[model samples]
Target chain A: MRPSDIAFRLYLVALFTFVFLPILTSMVFSLNSDRFPTVPLGEFTTHWYKTAFSRPEVWTAFGNSLIVAVCAAALSTALGFVTAYTDFRYGFRFKPAYLALALLPPTIPLVIMGLAMLAWLGRLGISGTLSGIVVAHTVMGAPFAMAICRLRLSQMDPALEAAAWNLGASQWRAMRAVVIPFCLPALISAYCLTAAVSFDEFIVAWFVSGLNKTVPVMILEILQGNVDPQINAIGTVVFLTSMALVIVAQLLILRKTNA
Target chain B: MTDTDPLVRFSGVRKTYGTFEAVKHLDLDIGRGEFVAIMGPSGCGKTTTLRMLAGLEEPTAGEITIDGKRMNEVSAHDRDTPLVWQSLALFPFLNVKENVEFGLKMRGVSKPDRHGRAMLWLERLGLKGFETRRIDQLSGGQRQRVALARSLVTEPRMLLLDEPLSALDAHLVIRMQGVLTRLQKELGITFVYVTHSQSEAFAMADRVVIMGHGEIAQIGKPQEIFRAPKNRFVAEFVGRNNILPGKTPGQEIVVAADRMQVSASDPGEGALPAEFLSEEFAGTGIICYFEGPEGVELKAQVTEDQLENLAPEPGQRFWLTWAPGAAHVMAGT
Candidate 1:
């Protein structure tokens, strides 16, 4: 091609390389056999992965994070379903205020939310437990779920519900048969995103988790003292799982919008 | 009207949204096995009244009785009134058979029975081979028929349709009208329909109920409502009709508008001369517009054969006349 076009192509290639090199380097280091992670010449081994797998503390943290993610996702999705349906279908006097209230938690800073949750739960003598972490994650995640589900609800035909009602179906049945099916993709996406957000979350979980270490918190602890092979292996696992969840969520979002 | 008791009765039924009354206090009786079309302008409470009858909305006042049962407290599902929506509202996720079976399934019908009934209706609606097809896969008319099959599968006593043909193409609309009329006849069920198009109301309804400002303006057979409109609103709304203001000298009143002065032998009291404005050809008839002395533009339809004798022109003034019994005068607003 032309000189300028070649130069522009080179620039794009450099930008792509800059963005992807670090991730590639990390993946390479994660498999390195040396005590200190290094470039290009280290022997590859599966020992770190095995060590990471066998570590009870790491597994416990992973399990804790999984549980917190699942419960938070389920709670957020349920609340979002209700919020979207209520806002779309009914005319309540406080709709604006209610919407603002639902959105408040997400707009607030995570640090502030974490601190507030710590204080509130401590006041009730319930701070730093798994349940407290779940509550915090659910509160933080619900707004995102609500936004996604609301968009889905807005795109759907209101006549679907009305049709069901006219066909001798109750409001509940209409929701179940018509409305819910239309919103399913959004609901699934919201759940996945909520789960992924809770899984990767550090600040909020750190404050509300007390002695119960989530995967992020455990990774942070492991990285602080030394650069262990086990840490790299655990990081790789977390990165893979998060990527999978995010990809699934994005696909669901695409389907929902297109449909 | 038939001698059989009315299947659905509305006595002073009204519904209001906040301060906006959608359906004013109104009375109507739909006889058993009758196809009744509720017709009106937009915001005239036709759909609102249908919703109230379907138990989707509760009346602010008055009573609705269906099959000798007070329906105010009954839920939508138990009302057994199926409504065919203008959008069809077929469940996109469900295939044709499943969509048709949805209502019966919700009512806890056994699986085999639901499928059997759904298949029966689907076959009856000429959709037997397409039962496995998704809603999006069907053509517009086909989707409409699927919606009908779904509603009819439940064998409801009354069917309420809210402008079901408004979304279809003109050709499809006419075809669907025939299908709907035949279905209603064969099922022998009460059909309460709401529409804003006068042609649809005229073509399909055994009786037409015209609404305005959330109240019933006139209720009668298609021919009756079209031939003898009770007031200026119904006259203008039912079809093209020429109206002019005229007063009776003794028993005879002269209505002059659009170069036509017609005299009514029994013109009602307070009739006066109305100004004639314009005229337009409408295929089978010609519509002449006039502004009555009351400042109301009135429309009148003259058939093709009648156009020859009158020989209407823009400003050529002629006497406007109608039989005394032909004019229906309303009370002063």
Candidate 2:
């Protein structure tokens, strides 16, 4: 091949290696029998996995994280779809401002957002609960969902909804019959992405998930208590959960149609 | 309304986008089962007029009535006027059978009944055995037939078409024109078609309404408009005719291209001096462009045999004349 083609291939390999090498190392060390993570001498074993699973707190944290991720994903996708549809279907004086507001949450610093949510939920008397973490994650995750749904809506034929109405479908009926089906791929993608975000989030969960520690929060505590080998086992599971969710999300929307 | 009365009427209707008027005050009456074509240049409010009739746009000023019922407040879904869009707008996510049955399903028709009716239309439109095929798999003409079937399956009293054939091949457009005309006559339903094409309108419409600049320039049978345009705009837009500045001020003469004959030598008195400019072959006929006195531009149609006999080249002097009564004097222009 040409020199530029060879360079491009090398760039891709380097990029993927940079992104995945840390995860691969964690996976490898999770099975190693060595006390400290080092190269060239450890035996392969499932000792860390057994140690991580035996702790009852890790089980509790896993359960808490799963519930928060599910609830947050559902709420974020629902809110995002509405926000996207409103942007797609309406024209008004402040439309640009409205869209900017809809997409604003993701741009805010996570620490500031986490603090704001902690304060707000404490005032509402649900602070330090699983519900508080769910609420906080929903706010942080919604803009990503909205961005995905907006891209899908842009690809849609603008006249499809109007054509449905012209064919005798009522407003609600057209939404069900045309708009929702057209955006189904985007909705599932958004759900998966938001679930992955909530499942793997750290800074925000560390602030609001007080007694109800999620997997990331548990991993941090384990790491700080000592440089525990058990951290690798939990980190591998977290990596797999996130990778599976992300892959599913990408597959749903990236399978091109003859548009 | 009685059988003799108009099925749709627009009285003092006006539509504006902010300060720009898309359709000025308009009054029109469409008889039952009539095929009417509204045509104009782009941005000439032809589509605005069609959209108003279909209840997609609420008129800014007066009223639109379908069969004596005021439709100013009627929502688009409540109207039976199904429009065949220029883009076809077929749902890519839905298969052919599902797309065709969408209207009936929304109207709460039973599943078996909807399926039977949809299948009947699909077959009628020559789309048999393609029911389960996805929209993206169909050809352009097949998708067009699908759009027609979807709109017609509702069996509405009237149908609206907005330049629906603009995207087809020339031969396919001609074929679809035949399909549309035959369907209109067979179903005995009013078809209000909007286009910018003169040929499509004249070929299929019983009457043609020519619009320009948000107003009706003229409305008449195609032959009448061809023979006698109400004004200069209709004269220029509808047919390829020689519009001449008459002998006196405030007068214009319109001669159909076919009516004027060309010759190398002077024919006699009343024959005009002209110079041949260019010629274009149009099927069996050739359109020979000429320039007259005072730089007046004109065109004459001659058969290929006639063009050979004349053998006029660019800048060749010729005599252009017509029968006295063949030229129409458009009074206002």
Clashes of each: 24, 0
Residue B93 displacement (Å), model 2: 1.0
Per-residue lDDT of candidate 1, residues B273-302 (tens digit): 544567788755677665654565555566
Give, for candidate 2 chain A, the lowest lDDT window spanning 10 residues: A250-259
TM-score of chain B of each: 0.82, 0.98
Model 2 has an lDDT value of 0.92
Judging by lDDT against the true structure, name the best candidate: 2
Off by over 4 Å in 1: A1-21, A33-47, A256-259, B1-3, B249-333
Candidate 2: segments with Cα more than 4 A from true spot: none
Q: Put down candidate 2 lDDT per residue, B1-333, tens digits, no spaces.
A: 599889999999999999999999789999999999999999999999988887788899999999999999999999999999989999999999999998898889999999999999999999999999999999989999999999999899999999999999999999999999999999999999999999999999999999999999999998988999988999999767989877789899999898998888887998989999999887648999999998988899999889889998899999999998888989785
Please report the candidate that would top DockQ against the real structure.
2
**Predicted structure 1, TM vs. truth:** 0.86
